[model samples]
Target: MREEAPRTVTAICRALQEQIECGLLPQGGKLPAERQLAEVFDTTRITLREALGQMEAQGLIYREDRRGWFVSPPRIAYNPLVRSHFHAMVGEQGRVPETEVLSARIVPTPAEMCARLELPALSSVIQIRRARRIDGRLVLYVEHYLNPQVFPGILDFDLTRSLTDLYASHYDIRYGRVAFDMVPTALPAEAASILKVTAGSPALLITRVNRDQHGRVIDCDVEYWRHDAIHVSVEVPD
Candidate 1:
């Protein structure tokens, strides 16, 4: 006998939840197609979709446009005090990290940016935008603003590689004291589009100011990360 709509939805949700809990559907694994999943659950497409929607709301799954749903991966641990860059941190967890440079240019520093970097009025800053991924999933988008006077000719270098390494190698400027500010917010449109997530999705906004040994500001970084994609952790002394 065909079950009632409510009962059918509940049963399907329970079954899929069990699959995830029991590791039958591993983290980061793609869920079966909608048609296949519906047939296996012996439910109508609408019911199956309802079940999937429940899972997505619970952060058990996520969808990419033009791509099917995937089980959510465990969040990456991020320590604000750690000096490691994104690549090292992701690699330490055995996940592949990739970066794509979206744009690099010299633009007049905005008022707020000038204050953040302590730049003089009418200063020009080198801005670089990048998308960072882990295991082929977009996790972070960043905008880097560099002091042009400190890093002359920086725009001529290959911007796709790690900026940390570039700073050390090309300019002998290693990271010194750093400051971090984090906030919970909704993803902006450009970030949402690049990350393949809907606008207004929950996210973390992290702002970092990097300095050199001489206490001179090197650059400031603004990073936006999916709320479900990272876990921030830090150890504080008693």
Candidate 2:
């Protein structure tokens, strides 16, 4: 028999990645049985398990105790700068939260975005595009990016629903610390279209990052506030 090159976990992950790329495995689909994979690769059970573990780490799959691994879903988003929930934010000034999800997908993070999030190159990221309205009047257009591995099934969530509550109840993510910075600018054509405002209208671009009890970054969100509608509250540091 020809000498067989030792199979490694990286090789296993690469094999699965290729399968996914070729559509042999579709999104939201379960992975093969561990034993079947082990047999196909002609590898020891331990080596097969190592491969599975690597895949899980890369957000390709998720495993439940006593249950097998399944393909992992995308991540959800919430801003940490403001102490208000999504519902509360919309409800401010007695406005109803009306939201429409424009798009949700997984993509390789761009260099600019990766730098902001401090993520590695080519890491998988979930992007959410949405429009928010108050009293049936559009006021904000948002593009959210999240790390899918941390908060799975985020894309399946009701986009109009309160993401903050969902994270707290489902994922045990409660942001204990929040910080934000703001910059003033004229609304671009794209943002104006969704907000139903004229181009060059004044706007506030707010950047926020939040940390959980364990000091892990739970959420990082950028908010676009209509100039006429938003108010700033601050305390100056000595």
Candidate 3:
């Protein structure tokens, strides 16, 4: 009976895997409830969940809080040095992009942040938190720290829109030098909660520092992304 149970789980996994591969289960489509799925697979709930867990680890599916499992969309390709904005980049790949500003405020800069921006101790900065979604899937949460002195009254503007455009129109500040450091990490509780995933799930952390024409740091951004939702690509010249 033990040997037969293992084979049953494997069979269930293969059956569902085929559906996903064949597009019978479309991307972003939610799977049926656990009880329903168990019935459909003709297996015990425990065995069915085991099969589904494997698929989740394989990046074939994901789960949302209080929601069912869903087929994951194709990973977006991100070029670190590219000047494109998030909306433009996602649109180029035939996906809809949306951004929601979670909060914005003028806060005393942390010691490390002040050092990064070359500001005096305890300088004030505008901090913005935002969530980004692609094709209706929440994929990234970002925190931006901006030098308030450079762009006074910045908090008065609509922050939920594209910051790139806002910078150009208001301050005529375009991107200059950008530095990126990316790593795979376990999602923190705050980030995972916002993205509707389990805490400590696999994720990607991207840290960026942007400079102006004069080499003065303008902003520091930290992005937390779903590990299965993006692929980083960049070209190198010999």
The lDDT, on a scale of 0 to 1, for candidate 2 is 0.68
Point out the higher-scoring one by TM-score: 2 or 3.
3
- Counting clashing residue pairs in each candidate, in order, gives 0, 0, 0
Question: Candidate 2 residues 1-238, lDDT tens each?
Answer: 1233234666888988898777788755777788888899888788888777677556566454345666544322334445677568656546566778878889888776687666889887788777776554445677777767768998887866767787788888887777676798777888876675557656678776666777766556767755544456545558
Off by more than 4 A, model 2:
1-82, 234-238
Kindly report which residue pairs in candidate 1 clash with one another.
none
Model 1 bad stretches (over 4 Å): 1-14, 34-54
**Which lDDT values do the candidates have, in the order given?**
0.90, 0.68, 0.90
Please provide, for model 1 over 58-138, each residue's C-alpha lDDT reduced to its tens digit, 9 standing for 90 to 100.
777887767888999998999988889999999999999999999999999989899999998999899999999999999
* Candidate 2: clashing pairs of residues: none
Candidate with the greatest TM-score versus the true structure: 3
The window of 10 residues in a row where model 1 has the poorest summed lDDT is 1-10
Taking the tens digit of each residue's C-alpha lDDT, what string does model 3 give over 100-145? 9999999999898888778899688889999999998999999999
Q: Which candidate model has the greater lDDT, 1 or 2?
A: 1
TM-score of 2: 0.60
